[model samples]
Target: MRFLLVEDNAELGDAVVAWLSMEGHAVDHALTLAEAHDWLAVAEYDLMLLDVMLPDGDGRSFLRETRTAERLPVIVLTARSQVADRVDTLDLGADDYLTKPFDFAELEARCRAVLRRRGTPAPVVIPLGSALFDPSSGTLTQDGESQRLRNRELRLLEVFARNKGQILSKSHLLDRLFSQDAEVTENAIEVYVGRLRRRLQQAGVQIETVRGVGYRMTAP
Candidate 1:
């Protein structure tokens, strides 16, 4: 998934970004509220990890603005663990809360759960004929055998599963998969789609290709 990390502490920000990236998530880091706002104005993010105290402004204000215009999912990470603080943040539309000096594993789990809750109505354990697609681990399994996916493959499958029956155009897929990157050609999308298709087929899933539109995942 694509994530925005709004944190001011340089060391902490770098560590979080690296950890999330290693877990197959595309992460963009912003050190201040201004930078976060600028990025939010142009790009789309699956989830945001925000720090309450920012250098330029309070993250709560930013969260409020996002709530007014869009339904962006945010997880407030701050040192203040007071009940009032949590209630205020949740009232302002934060989906989850994590206090400072927390475990990174817990943060990762929360991120996955938040994004999955916002996704399409696919089962937590996706069943495709005899195969099962586990979103949590990004793994495909069949007859008790399983294999993990690469970052790009996992991302491509996540998009497909989220928009199950929709015909996603190549441009749209590229935009979601390679956000803020250089222009990606349709060929690149095709190649990745081909790879994902083969993997899914091995696990007994079916992905349909529309003549001139795009691709869609159909029930087995």
Candidate 2:
């Protein structure tokens, strides 16, 4: 997934970016609202980790303005820990709020929760034959065995499961699978698709190629 981190604290920014990147996500750090706007103009992001205070402007204002146009999921990261502060931020359209000096694990869990709530609603657990697919955690389990999926592979499966039967062109897959700044080739999609195909074979699912077009997920 691609994320935009709008923050000014150098130490915190570096740690957050490093942590998320290690999980195979593309992350962009913007120290100011001006830079955040620039990033938004250039690329799309699945989520935004925003700081309430910035060098140039208040992130709350940016969040308010952003709400007027897009439904970008935002989690406000700030030093304000008061109950009223959380309520006010939520009132301003923040999806979640994290107090400063937070554990990275909790932060990640909140991020996942916010995304699951904001995303196009998918089944909590989708059954593919004997395997159970959990979209929230991006895990596939069968009996007592769980398939460990790579980041890209998991994302590809999620897309297919959501759009199930609809034809997805290679270009569309490319856009969905990679960040705008990623140096990827169309062949990369084919590679991931192949990997997912093998994994899903036992789950009673098939990825059908649409000839000159792209691919679709089908079930017997």
Candidate 3:
């Protein structure tokens, strides 16, 4: 999962980022509201950990501005513990709230809870025939054995696994396989698909190419 951490406290921000990354997540940190907004403009994120205080503006204000348009889940990280503060943050659009001096374990749990509420949390392990795909760490195992995958291959497989049994257009696959800034051709998508099909076949999952359409995952 990808998360954006908007925090001004260097120690706390570094700890949180390190913890989440160790647990197999991609994280971006911003020290100010403006920097956070800049990151949000170009990349996709699953959840955001926002701090209430910033150098340029209040995080609450930023939340209010984005509440109507943003779809990613948000958890407010602040030192305020008053009932009214929590209530107001929730009312403004925070999916959850965390006070300062929090344990990393609890923070991870809250992150999962918010994602679950949005119905976007990935399973710990995806079982396909005799294969197992752990989306968190992007690990694949087959018949009690683990399979090594390149970064791109793992990402491509994740996209296919999440939308299993559905036809994914070439354009859609291309977009999902690469970041917004990546420039990959449509034909390049075919090469990745072909590689995935051969390797996954060993684990009993077939990625079938639909005639002149796209690709679908099915049991062999």
Candidate 4:
């Protein structure tokens, strides 16, 4: 997932960005409303984490102005806990609101829920023979049992499952598995693919090497 975090507080901004990155998300952060707008103009984001207060402008005004202009999902971060404030923000098109001093875990959960609502209509539970893959939770189950996987391996598996039977090159896998700024080598992909192939054997899934090409996934 790609996210835009618009927060003036450096500490909070850094914390959120780090947490999201650890969860396999690409985050672009801005400290002001103008900077946030610039990001929105150039690149599309899966989600936006906007603050109610900005040095240059009110975040609510920004939300109101661009709500109809784009289909981006937004979750408002504000200290305002009053019913009127919440109602007004919601009316102005905020998808979810989090007050100050909120739990980081709760924030993560809300962000995920908002994304689930805005994300593609594709099914979360993908079946591979007797295996069940939930991209949302990053879990795989085989024959009613859960299997452990490294985060990168799980993400790589999801890419293959989404594009099952299509040859996926090392470069394409690297792009999908890591953020634009992530330092990862093409050789790293080979390791993950190999690990996944061995682990997936019992699930009746196969990751076939395409000679000089790449890899493909099959469930039979």
Tens digit of per-residue lDDT, candidate 1, span 38-112:
888888888999999998999999999888988778899999989999999999899999999888999988886
Best by lDDT: 2
Candidate 4, residues 20-135, lDDT tens digits: the string is 77776667889999998887787667778899999999999999887979878899999999999999999999999999977878988898788778765443899887788887
Among all windows of ten consecutive residues in candidate 1, which has the lowest summed lDDT? 120-129
Candidate 4 C-alpha RMSD relative to the actual structure: 3.2
What C-alpha lDDT values do all the predictions have? Answer: 0.82, 0.85, 0.83, 0.84
Per-residue lDDT of candidate 2, residues 1-220 (tens digit) = 6789999999999999878766656688898999999999987888999999998999999999999989999999999999999999999999999999999989888888888898736447777666878866768998778877777777778778777889999988777666555688989998999998888888788999999999988875
Name the better of 1 and 3 by TM-score: 1
Taking the tens digit of each residue's C-alpha lDDT, what string does model 3 give over 12-79?
99899888766645678898999898989977888899999899999999999878787779999999
Q: lDDT at 139 for candidate 3?
A: 76
TM-score (all chains, Cα) for each model: 0.78, 0.81, 0.70, 0.78
Candidate 1 Cα misplacement greater than 4 A, ranges: 115-123, 179-188, 202-214, 218-220
Clashes per candidate, residues 3 or more apart or on different chains: 0, 0, 0, 0
